[model samples]
Target: MCTRYRVGASGKKLAERYGAVEAACDAPGVEAFPKRRGWAVCAVKGELRLGTMGWGFPPPPNGRAPVVNVRNLASPFWRDALARPAQRCLVPVTEFCEWEGEAGRKRDRWFSVPSLEIFSFAGIWRQTAAGPVYAFLTCAPNALVAPVHPKAMPVILHPEDEARWLSGNIAEVLPLAAPFPSQLMALAE
Candidate 1:
């Protein structure tokens, strides 16, 4: 479900790559974990802005767990954020990790897009009492990730589709909720 990921670039590098202006906080460290702060690229007015946000959404009223990955866009809980352009965001990531092997012998398997040092995951964000929180969408795993994590993988966006994911309507952006091509991705040694 992409509970852990890495963003190796600094704020300046992220801003340059995304053509965004640095906003409130510096970029996150190489590794990002749930409930911690991470960098996200958001569209403000006509400009792109890079800022920090917590990684998980607050727990719902039923006392469920905090949401770190969004899989059901049609759910009422996430529909509002998915339908609004302002709530959409880009989660800059260098690599993502999934646990492999048996229950006690699980090991982290890192994956990345070989063609791009940094890529964006289709994300959504909203403000809560604690602070602003963000979560990225997940889809069926691709060939590369299926063996390690058969359930799902983050919905990674190509550089050319970053802007579209931020500004496009639900109808236009929903199609991007598919797995990235396996040929473009590699396993980190």
Candidate 2:
């Protein structure tokens, strides 16, 4: 549901929720065809660096629709992604935008860090022929996100899960498939 996000390392930006910052998001580049954009940490081009990644992983191998989301419930890459080493990534944003209120026409609201400066949204990534495309992982929506964009929650990683998510087995990382604490989330006007 969160397609737009603000990327930065400042505690003031993400609401002081994010702890470590190995790398900040790479600003979008100017190109005729731009890659999907979001904060990420993955082995792109054989390098594990934190930066903004394109939303869609790539033109699918099976000619599937654009893989913009790493949906655990439906993404074909779910099993593969979970099995892949350290597919975990994060999104640090000042505000996440979403539409709400109606079934046909909705209004967008800007959600920012309430008590902290910045926070990381749960995500996953995979290297593609074009580059490293990311699919922000999602689970069942919580009470907070339900009213706004009711579908799923990002794969928020706990501080303890960071190391393991970046190195542990699929079984080990599966437990992180939940929404972040509601206390840490706030809807932006």
Candidate 3:
């Protein structure tokens, strides 16, 4: 859902607010997420760590589809791969991109954010022998993002709920996504 974003002064403020310590801005193709560039995954050291994952969530063995949206998690095709809810470290991010227009004449670069300056995104990760890989989980768009991205949006997190999200439990923070509010995120007009 949130495929692209601009990380300017706003990102700096977000980093400080969330106490995002080490930044691993090696998200392979930075353009995939736009101004948010190069897999900007943030970690809280002993607390938690996260970053932009390969947009398409490549399925496990025998599964060739790569799903970036949770909507597919329940699909018969991917339910097997996503049957289990994941609680890995993820930050949906304060802003992301969507497109406007018909397929042939479609326009990209739809920027979305919350009423607040920046919001954290929900994500999941697996413990690997090397380290951790994160993905910005997706969900249906709220009224705000619906017109912009028709498909979905990454799970946006409340600033105060960061700790709870780290636990990987979706129930505790389900209510936050409701009552979507409009934020004043400008695209450098």
Candidate 2 residue 132 C-alpha distance from true site, Å: 1.4
Clash pairs, candidate 1, are none
Candidate 1, superposed: residue stretches over 4 Å from native: none
The C-alpha RMSD of each candidate to the native structure, in angstroms, is 1.0, 4.9, 4.9
Give per-residue CA lDDT, model 1, range 126-174, as digits (tens): 9988888999999999999999999999999989999999999899999
Model 3 lDDT per residue over 58-163, tens place: 4667866544445544455443323233434545344566767788996765554536555556554443343444455567766766776767766666666666
TM-score of each: 0.97, 0.72, 0.64
Model 2 error, position 28 (Å): 2.5
Candidate 3 — worst ten consecutive residues by lDDT sum?
Answer: 34-43
Per-model CA lDDT versus the true structure: 0.93, 0.59, 0.50
Model 3 residue 59 lDDT score:
60
- Which numbered prediction scores highest in lDDT against the true structure? 1
Error of 2 at 56 (Å): 1.1
Number of backbone-clashing residue pairs for each candidate, in the order shown: 0, 16, 12
Candidate 3 residue runs with Cα over 4 Å from true position: 9-15, 23-30, 33-46, 50-55, 60-65, 72-87, 92-94, 127-131, 168-170, 174-179, 183-189
The candidate 1 region of ten consecutive residues with least summed lDDT is 21-30
> Candidate 2, 122: how far from true, in Å?
2.7
